[model samples]
Target: MANFFDFGLTLDLLRLPFVQLALVVAVVLGLLAGVLGPLIVSRNMAFSVHGTSELAFTGGAAALLLGWDIGNGALAGAIIAALVLGLLSRRSSEYDSVIGVVLAFGLGVGVLMLYFYKGRASNKFGLLTGQIVGQDFASFALLMACAAGVFAVLAVIYRPLLFASVDPEVARARGVPVTALALVFAVLVGVATALGVRTVGALLVLALMVTPAAAACRVTASPLRATVLSVLFALVSAVGGIILSLAPGAPISAFVTAISFVIYVVCWAVGRARGLTRA
Candidate 1:
């Protein structure tokens, strides 16, 4: 019994600098994505999240070329892309059309930047798959600031945003500015996407933002409960994935995605069993 309980050796890695940084990264990304993800999924903007993340990839890649902070670069890219999408598609019902055009342009730009970059291969690869374990204190601090800003804005706009998301026509009929809210939420989602790309990489940003919320959605139709559960699921996936990555050769994103997928599957099964699933 004593031998079975002896688990001290495996816990030593938690004290390492890199591990600590990764944990912080995981927490910030988890909370940010968790908070914004339900809103995104509710509005059927999961595709938009991917589109914005790819542009964020372009921005981060360009930042690597110019020797700037990749997170900030990604943030810049997401904001620009989201605003452009919102502004251009405000009066049009063909948002998918606009997103498709932007996605192509964003990917092309990212490829061009990667083509010309003379940095270490890991630096370029990190934009696609993340490199949070190597982050410094300054970067960590910057991440905290970004997280704070995202949460602050969310706190201010959560209720109206929820109303707008659930029913844009009803929200507008009740005097809510649906268009303005959409633009604001788009910017917020863009910021969250940039932060997600920083930790989970461009290729897997949606894994964190969409999967956990989707899983939560499957289990509960109550928006409040669903959002809370989504946050919990994201926290588990992010932190659990980081912890699992303490093992050699384990990629954090892979673990995170797997955990999220498993959670989604479990929730789907449960929802089906309870007749919570409509179809």
Candidate 2:
């Protein structure tokens, strides 16, 4: 058994710029995403996770095709995709179908474009599987700024957002702007997904965000409690995963995901036991 504590000590020793930035970005973004992901899952927008991630892929592809800045293309793609989902979510009836269509088409287009740009493997991998670990101070600064901005927005909207999430009909009846909340959340999620692709990769970002939160939620019914637990779990997973990956031959994604899965299983079991005891 690898000691994540000692493993973590190793990471602190090398201190590569890329690794440092990754650790910071992952910890910050993972904390925010885990805190919010459960709320999103409660609102039954799980599909939106997949949709936004695919759209992010398309954005990276476009950036590669146009030879523009990768981050710029990704942000643009994410914004456009989130707008579509936000609008569709208002209908509530056809939202799933619309999102599914968009996700599929966007993924197809991204794959095709990647095929056309065969030589841009580094960019493709960065957007797709998250291999780009090093960021200049400027990029790291921008990522931190985005993370801070997102954290602030989420904090400001937390109360109403939680109310609206648990019961949209009641919240709306109480005069909460559920529609606007949805739009804001979609945009935030879109941006977060784009940024997260840098650390967790598009494939694993949702796992980092949603899984820890889901696990925490199994143990706590109170929203605030769950949020706190979720953040804690996410931080553990990110920091632990980074530390594990620093060891001789470990993949960060696998380590992080396994930790998250373990947490989820433990929480699920505890929840089930409590339910049975109640019965």
**Candidate closest to the true structure, highest lDDT:** 1
Candidate 2 Cα outliers beyond 4 Å, as residue runs: 1-13, 132-134, 248-251
Best by TM-score: 1
Q: Give per-residue CA lDDT, model 2, range 99-137, as digits (tens).
A: 999999999998898888866466677677665353557
Candidate 1 stretches with Cα past 4 Å from truth are 1-10, 276-279
Question: What's the TM for model 1?
Answer: 0.93
lDDT of 1 by residue, 31-59 (tens): 88888888989998998999999999999
Error of 2 at 107 (Å): 0.6
lDDT of 1: 0.85
Steric clash count of candidate 1: 0
lDDT of 1 at 225: 91
TM-score of each: 0.93, 0.90
Q: How far off is residue 266 in model 2, in Å?
A: 1.1
lDDT agreement with native, every candidate: 0.85, 0.78
Error of 1 at 173 (Å): 0.9
Clashing residue pairs in candidate 2 (N, C-alpha, C atoms within 3 angstroms): none
